[model samples]
Target: MEHNLLQAFTTRKHTVLTSSKIDPTGATSTGSLKVKDNISTQGSQEKLGKSGEEEKNLKSNKKLEMRAKDTGSFNIKMNPLNKDSLDKPDENGREEKSTESSKKMQTKKSETGEGHDNSSFEAHQETQGAKGHHGNQTTTAKIQQTTAFISKQDNKRQANQTQIGRSGSNVMLDVRRRDCSKTKCQYVIWQCHHQCMGWGDRLRGIISVYAFAILTGREYRISHTFPCNLKEFFHGNKTLWDEKVITAEHATKRNIKLFGFLPTFGSWVLQSSNLSETFPEDIITFRTNNDIIPYLRFNKNFTKTIEKAFSMPIDDFHYVTLFRRLFHELFSPNKQFEEKFQKYYQLLKPSNDSTLVCAQIRLQFIKVSGMKNVFKFLQETIKRVGKSKLLVSTDAENVRSAAKTLFPEQLVDIEGPLGHVDKPGSGCRDMEKALTDFLMLSKCDILIHSPSGFGQQAAMLKYPYKDVYQINYAGVITNLTIPIFKLENLYEELGPLGGEQPPSLPSRYIKNPQKYFT
Candidate 1:
């Protein structure tokens, strides 16, 4: 009986070991059979004491085999069936492998100079997470790096689009056309009816009318037929302003009320209750040589309107900012004028490191020629600025000849007969030269000019107002503190013109502004 019980216990122990090795789900049943076999074997050993030692040794061997099989089964159940899992080592080895894989991917990405797609990267991250904790961390870092690269690329594309838009590319032109098509646009036509004014004067009137048009929400147009069509030299920057939009019926007296001078007109508009109500005409034409910016600055209503239209604060509203915006928006050189400007500008060879000084000598408007003093100032300025180029723009041929002869090394000017745009018999070629000089003068580092509106307007084009000196009638050089757009400065310099005094709000209007507006 003892022999039979021992043999049966051995057979049951072998079965439990085989089942546990083959299937992890048999662990519970294998454990129960082991317990039962141990009880039976111990009983058989005690009943047959002669083979007790052998039985004890066999039981010990069985416990070792069962433990080994159980551990193997648990491992097979816990681990996933994947190549990475099958080859994985201990915790330290997995961490090292994760680090190595991350470095390899980064190096490959850098070598190829390419970014991973977002969807593919996300899938990689999920696979890495399933592999190990260290791999998940590495994937997180890669995601941040790739995301930043994508963001940078997006920003670059946006910047390029913005630059294209500002250059008046076809995209922006189409957008403007769409906007105009959506509404019945109103216009303020600035007509030059044989006005005895120079280019500077006409520009001032045009910009003034443009400002009014902005306040009244109307498009600004130009009709200058005295010397030549304005389009012969200049065209619009973002828009076209010519007679094509106007017809014979639209040019009647009713739509052509003229505002003779800017100061008086500005005063009348400011004091009036409402501009639209007072001037009911659809197309009000202005023909003046003076700017209404200084007058507009004083009117609270006008300032508010301007600020809103430009999306700027009133404090930021100044001569330089305002004039630059208007000039660039309204005027662009035509093909002929642009070619001439480029030729002269190239002759100057303006450099970023080296300074280029512009001297505008207008003998037509100023009473005294301060030629000697002007030369002296130029010499001092050149010496101060070290390596420099000097560009001279003037209406007189003798002045140009003198400058070229005196400063041959530094002097640069267009070779042509100078002529005023407003004067009759000034051919289109000469007028184009004048326009080219005006634009080139604005592109200088320093400016030395005479007390002429042409010089003043040219100087206004330079942003942040560079070192500018004005030579008076007595040939005395003075540094202009404020731009010519300032009311006090303009009034002091130009004095009362067009038989109109400096703009002043009426006392009644000043006391009760609401009463006048209402």
Candidate 2:
């Protein structure tokens, strides 16, 4: 009976050993029987009293332990089988088991779930890790896109801010439409004729009329078609001053021309207490060379109204500031003028380090002695500024030749016949050249010019009004005060009280003076 029992036990052990399979980590393929098979095989070997077989089993167990350590696999110590040794759910709701059964159970779970027996749980874990990495990569790409968009918006905002800051008070000029029709709208048209006036005088009249329109709540337009169309050189920026909008019939019936500095109208038309009442006509046209900005500035009521209209303080409306704002608000260089202007500006090759001194020598107006003094003043200015380029703009060809002869290396001037804008002989190209010269003078750092309205207007348009020295008829260089807009300067030619004469008509006229009126 004992021999029979020993043989049966040996047969059972042999069957268990043949049925079990060991993985590379030494865990059995059948998870449920892994610990059980190891214990049963050891017990059967001891019972048979086979010392060599026992030694062989010990050697194999040692080899598995070494292999587990080398492969960084979890080594299972011999332990009794229990209910907890079976696969149980972990915190993540995934199946987990004891060290001895973990690999085998995970393998079986993967085979059952995915129908891929060759693909182990470790391979699935690697795929999940790769997926997590890709997810992180996707998140990183979105973050970079968001950052780039924000940076682009920031740069755009900065550019807009720079433009606004550079424009100064000009940005505050009312661009909103007045919403009025041709007949119904009260208009202040700057009428230009074939008179003895230049571009500077025309600009002054336009600025004055525009300011008058602003103060009295009227639409401003330009009717300059004598020598050439005003649209040839300049175009309207925010407000279009197209003369075609005004009909010939309307101009004939409703237009009232007011000339400044004359005995009849004098300055009373501009100084009238009630312009709307004084001139009840639909269109009030101005044909004057006198700058009425100072007169407008002297009128406290007018200044207050302008300040209120523009929503700016009275003090902030300096002479230069107001002139610049009016000039830019009314006109922008047309494409043709702009192209020529850019061509000359590029010729200068202006940069932060380069200093350009503009010298305007009007031979038509300035005498020979004055011209000499002007050149002397320019030489002194160039010497003072140090390493300067002299840009010469003049109405006479002789002045250009003289400047080139004087400063061959440092002189810069456009090669063109200088022509007056108001002259009948001047063509479109001449007008374009004149406008280009005016704009280029404004770009210079320092201005040494003769006593000419052209030079004065250019200086007024200059931003940050740098060193400006004007040479009078006697050839004396006077340092003109900047922001040329001052109450005293406005009242200089006019009396201390702001005007020489009062309005000819009363504030309220009982009868319309039809003979004198439009």
Candidate 3:
């Protein structure tokens, strides 16, 4: 009375499908099954009208048979006793139908000399045609998709592992791959609109600029004007170097310096001039520092201003937490420095808990009287801490030789980075040496340094910084304000490192790259 169509297709299990029809009165059947979208579902059914004529032809035998046959049209039938059948027959009729169906099936098998072998073969080529089924994707596709996903996850895990490898060294060089792949707004350029000062003063000014960037809620990158290209030393990307850094800015700083000492007086303000043409809308108001804020003062009002700018509570007053996080995620010594540092560290690392003193005396700061004071302090310090080892890192070779002569029994020193010039070729070599020396001092149990920028930077790099010994002009060595590590250190990382990483994109600079990368 009606037509039904079945298809062969793939599913989660990728099973093959087949359909069967019975000729109740020897009717014709003709159709083919297909997979995927290859076949249509409209089928033919012409039955029952010729049943009387067919029955009359077989009445002489007084028997009925159920078998599959092919004619111009399909004629499918089912007995009441069959579970799939629509009719429900009485108990007697059901028994009779079962007996007749079984006898007919046996007769067909005997005629063929074998039973149907359902498990003898896999699904034919007909079934393999379809790529997918309703609500189920093909197994092959699913496997390929899963494999791609796992590969990405594995890459990230390996990156994090590489980051952990740096823990053996003194510098906290955790290299978490920051996912800055998202589209980013233009980043503000942070540089001291000046270049006439020494590398030390320039570095401090750069730090101040960075702090401003952090407070303003805009992405920031440095514009290194010194001879040593910071981007090259740190292995940063060329795209991030701010090629458009205003040269006029530097000229202005130099011009003002010629006239007086007050050029640096009110320079720490967010002005239209300081705002890079690339990112002008980042700060709403242009204002100067209320009082030229010192480097170490995370003073109450300044602290509040930063907290409000970021709209969060800053629990650590020293801001060491913030500064270290920034340093770890931004600056890293290159391969040469790393290998050199490891070599020196192994050579100097103490065998036991015996107090190892690392003295970072700047040649510029050490005078005749101060030199005597330093000698006295070293002797007194050695006597006070038994089995103590001494390591001195200084800018001048004379200081290195003097320390060695004074304490012939202890390890003396390595000459600090060859006079501090800031160019890439020879200057970079000097930078590398300084980096190694910084690592040497950081690894020692007791750190001693003077007010020199190079020495100060080394002291600040070490955690529990509060224990660092700062030597005054009087040659007195004592720990200044003890700097402690912040909770942020546990998760912050030095974005992606090395040249081979996927270049950072502004879009992927997620609000918190660590949460996802970790």
* Most TM-score-accurate candidate: 2
* Every candidate's lDDT: 0.45, 0.47, 0.35
Assess candidate 3 and give its TM-score to the true structure.
0.46
Model 2 spans > 4 angstroms off:
1-171, 181-183, 243-253, 258-260, 263-273, 294-303, 310-321, 380-387, 483-490, 493-518
Show the lowest summed lDDT stretch of 10 residues, model 1. Answer: 138-147
Q: Name the lDDT value of residue 96 in candidate 2.
A: 28
* Candidate order, lDDT descending: 2, 1, 3
Candidates in order, TM-scores: namely: 0.56, 0.58, 0.46
lDDT of 2 by residue, 1-518 (tens): 32331122121123222212322122223311111111121111111111232235335545654543344333322223321111222334322223334222211222112222211111111000001101110000000001111001010112121111133343557655555653456677677656536777667668766877887787778877656677887777777776334434334223323332221122333335665654455555555554555555544556667678655555444344456677777887677766776676655644445567788876543434344345444555555556667788887655665566666677877866675665567666666667777777777767766545677778766655545655544334445434222112223333232222211101111122111111
396-438, model 3: which lDDT tens digit per residue?
A: 5555555565566677455445444433334555655655566
Residues 113-203 of candidate 1: C-alpha lDDT, one tens digit per residue: 1222211011011010011111111000000001111001010112121111122212111113323455455666677656335676567
Clashing pairs in 2: 319-485
List ranges where model 3 is wrong by over 4 Å: 1-184, 191-202, 231-305, 308-322, 350-354, 415-417, 422-426, 481-518
